[model samples]
Target chain A: MRYLLIYDITHDGTRSKVADVCLDYGLNRIQYSAFLGELSPAHQRELLLKVHQRLGKHGANIQLFPLDEKAWVGRKSIEREERQNNE
Target chain B: MRYLLIYDITHDGTRSKVADVCLDYGLNRIQYSAFLGELSPAHQRELLLKVHQRLGKHGANIQLFPLDEKAWVGRKSIEREERQNNE
Candidate 1:
C-alpha cells in the first residue's frame, strides 16, 4: 500500500532523525517534511511505532496517511519552481 | 473526494495569502503548511488555478493530493503534544 507521511518538528536534530527513519523505511521525501511511498501493513505499524518512539514527547506532530490504489491514482498536485535552499 | 494540500512559502505575506486560498477552498489546516479536506473534482481544478495564480513565480511549492475513499479510510497518524505557538 502507498502512504503519505508528513511531520512538524521544530528541533533540527529530532526532525532530521525522524526524516532518516522515514528514509530507512524506503519512503520518498516529497517535501522537506513530507514523504510518500509504499509499505506493507506490518511495516506501516512498525514505522508508526518507530516514529512514535522517535518523537518521545518532543512535542512534534507526525501523520501517516495510507493510500490505497484508488487514492494513489486519484492524487493531484500543482508544483512551481522552488528555491534550492527550500528544496 | 478527500484531498491533502501542503506548501512552503518563504514570504510571510505570500504564505498567508496562499493559506487563505486553501481555507477558502474549505481545506482544514492540519499543520502549519498542510491542509486536508473534501473537494469536488471541479473545485479541485479551480483551487489549483487559484493557488497557481497566487504563486505567480514566487518560487513557492504547493501540492494538492486528491484522496479516494479507500485511502482516506486507511490513513494512519501519530501526533504528539504540540506547543501552543506552533499550533
Candidate 2:
C-alpha cells in the first residue's frame, strides 16, 4: 500500500537527519514536511517502528495516511522522472 | 492533473447533496469529506467555480491539493474496481 506520512520534527537540526533516514528506507520526499512511500504491510510496520525509534519521544507529530492506488501513480511518476534525471 | 478537494459542509443536510454533485462530476469520494479527482486545468477551474456557486457562503472551508502522478494511481485503481463491480 502507498502511504503519505506527514510529520513535524520536534528537535532542532533533525529535519535533514530524519529525511536522510526516510530516503534510505525508500520513502519519497514530497513536500519539505511530507513523504510518500509504497511498502508491503510488513515493511510499513517496520518503517513506522524504526521512525519512532529514531525519533524517540522528540518526533513532534506524525500522521500516516493510507492512500488509494490513484494517489501513488502521480508520486511514482515524479520519482521516476527524478531518477531518470539523476537529481 | 489530479487534485484532492477537502471540504466541510456548513449547513445541515448538504452532505448527501454535495456528494451527489461530486459524483456527477466524476470526483471520487474518498473520506466522507474528501474527494479525489483527475481534471484538466480548465475542468478544475470550472469545477471549483461550480462548487463555490453551489455552496455559496455556506461551504465551511475548501482546500485544494494538487497530487503528483503517483497519488493518482491508487485512486484510479479503486475507481476502476468500483466500476467493475455493479452488483
lDDT of every model, 2 decimals: 0.81, 0.58
- What fraction of the reference interface contacts is present in each model, in order? 0.65, 0.05
**How much is the lDDT of residue B55 in candidate 2?**
59
Tens digit per residue, CA lDDT, model 2, A19-72: 776687788976555666777777777776666556643435554556665544
Q: For residues B1-87, what per-residue lDDT tens digits would candidate 2 score against the true structure? A: 767665556455554665676677788976555666777887777776666556543434554566765544433210111112234
Instruction: List model 1 lDDT by residue over A16-70, tens digit each.
Output: 8889889999999988789988999888888888887776557787888877766
| Candidate 1 residue-wise lDDT, B1-87, digit = tens | 789998877778778888998899999999888999988889989888888787755677677777777667777776667546554
TM-score of each: 0.87, 0.42
Candidate 1: true contacts recovered, fraction:
0.65
CAPRI classification of candidate 1:
medium
DockQ of 1: 0.53
- What total of clashing residue pairs does each candidate reach? 0, 26
Q: DockQ scores for all the models shown?
A: 0.53, 0.05
> What stretches of model 2 exceed 4 Å from their correct place?
A70-87, B1-87
